[model samples]
Target: MSGGRHSWITFVSKVIPSLSLSLFGQVCGISGCFNILVGCGVPMRSINSFALIGMALSTFFTTLRSFSTATLQLKASKAFFLGFTNSIVSAPMVFFDSTTVGRIFTHAYIYIYVYITHLHTPTHTHIYMYIYTHTHICIHIYIYMYMYVCVYIYIYIYIYMYTYIYIYICMYVYY
Candidate 1:
């Protein structure tokens, strides 16, 4: 392919579908869980079971997406280094004669350093931060769900207690 255009096209093909699928899966799973938690229905056991399956599927798709993206990034970085090495090897003898080996290495080192700092470092950090925030959000959601269920349980208990007391008083007075 011309100028490695085909490789990029292939990378995109491998990446985009997984990315979209993962996003869709996550949305469906999260929404399903949310609905199961909030909606009125007595048969939550069945609905929650489905939501759990959806969430597991979502996690699987997300892992697949991450693996694809990582593989693509690895291929890209390898190509970059291969091209750099080829360029150095093909350079004219005169250029090497004029430039010291140290200077050549220094130049390559600087380029690679800058490239890694500008590209790889930020990407990894972004991924880490994104994962952190996502986990944090999930924890918060679980906490809220716990609190919501607890409140309802307490309310039901209180209602039952009061009803029992009222019935007992009525029976005692009538007797």
Candidate 2:
């Protein structure tokens, strides 16, 4: 949010999530390799895509924090700061050619957050506590619920749907 080259630096900061995607790929690849050893034939491409999506997800928080930190330092020129950083970085990957798992993971990140935030769950939440510690106990509980339902349950669904979609496309279309 600087005036000159600083603006460019601002843009560069947005790409931090993309860098994270690189790390995500490495981590997911290792995990996938382990799964393969355990007798799963998950497509390598899907694993790559999933890791990138994870990178995108990690990017969202990074972008927000960066913005907050920048705001604190009081840099001027806030013309169109990067938003929803994870979605932005991961978008091309998703549109171009994401594995089913990758797609699911990316989508789930958004959905999981939404679903978890729904109803402001764990109604026993104490706002005063968060005011002091800057953390919400209820929110964390909701997030864990999201992980259990959205992540754990849906991984296999992603795999199965991708497999099914691929088969259907191949059998029904010549392309």
Candidate 3:
């Protein structure tokens, strides 16, 4: 019963936020897919850019804040900054180049951490308590990322396809 209680507590405290973010991504992806199939202009590009910028800035500042506060000797701040910056810059490029299909899949990334953590168990010999301890923190890391990817992908695909069709139709009318 103690184990179950601990698991439930861990889940509520650690997994729920990540799951919620993942689920939000899933919904965004589905919305993108639907937009592609049936034209619905929803300011995907601007929203995406804003999301990217906001997420990058937040993560950057948060880490700097964490480093000064935490007593840990390890310096993971640089890597996190790089990753956060890279995601912000790269998401728009990838989605615009690929098919609208990519938008539908981007949200699945937020699930990676959660699902992976579930694969790990807290055992006496394994020392996975550390892993479980940081579980909730990971969600804060990826929330911006998942949304940025999906929105960028959706907007790019919609723009590319719609523009192409609009141009072709215009040419036919002119000719």
Candidate 4:
């Protein structure tokens, strides 16, 4: 009876935060994409100001969610490692034009940590865990690759449009 109760408590503590983080990631990803689209037509200065606020909020929520999950499920060292890994992995997104690979890599790093931690414990010793983790990683990689391709195409279009507009403005001003 006590064992079952403990299991239930563990499940609630772990699963709830995991689900929350997943939901937050989805929402932030969608919102960021929407903001990028809307900002294209607005003044760059105003859009950048608004985007700064939004990016701050997104970072705060992501950190909160990830920290909470790590603290809940992992040992102190592991939790720190997870947070550090995420920071390092996410850093490239600032310099890179596209985030699809960085995002997927972050997920893969977390999944790998999870797999390693699970293997260290006797209680979690199961073949299904291996299969489940690998399958999830594979699916995420495939999805992100497809999404990145589409994003690259959109970026190319945006660049071409901007170049065309710039050329037209230069000609009109000079003529």
Give me the runs in candidate 4 sitting further than 4 Å from their true place. Answer: 1-3, 39-175
Candidate 2: residue 70 lDDT (0-100): 31
Q: Output the worst ten-in-a-row residue range by lDDT, candidate 3.
A: 66-75
TM-score of each: 0.42, 0.22, 0.25, 0.27
In model 1, which regions exceed 4 Å deviation? 1-47, 119-175
Model 4 Cα lDDT, one tens digit per residue, 1-175: 3778898899899998878866865664454343344335544433345555664454444344434433344344346656765775666656556556557566765675566555654322332244344445554453344334334434443564455446434533543
Q: In TM-score terms, which candidate is top? A: 1
> In candidate 4, where is summed lDDT lowest over 10 consecutive residues?
122-131
Across 1-175, the per-residue lDDT of candidate 1 in tens digits comes to 2788888898799988878866764554454343233234434333345554554454444344444444454456457656766887888889888887557655665564445445544324533333333333443332233333334434443554455445434533543
How displaced is residue 130 in candidate 3, in Å?
32
- Which residue pairs clash in candidate 1? none
> Candidate 3 lDDT, tens digit per residue, 1-175?
3768898999999899878855654544343343232234334333344443543343334333323222121224335545755665566766756645334334443464455456653211122233334434544445444344334434444564456456434533543
In the range 1-175, model 2's lDDT, one tens digit per residue, is 4478887787688777657755654554343333233224334433344544543444444333323333332222112212333555666655656455445445645563454345342321222222212223333333244233333323433454355445434533432
What is the Cα-based TM-score of model 4? Answer: 0.27
Better of 2 and 3 by lDDT: 3
User: In angstroms, what RMSD does candidate 2 have relative to the true structure?
Assistant: 21.2
Candidate 2 runs further than 4 Å off: 15-143, 150-153, 156-159, 162-175
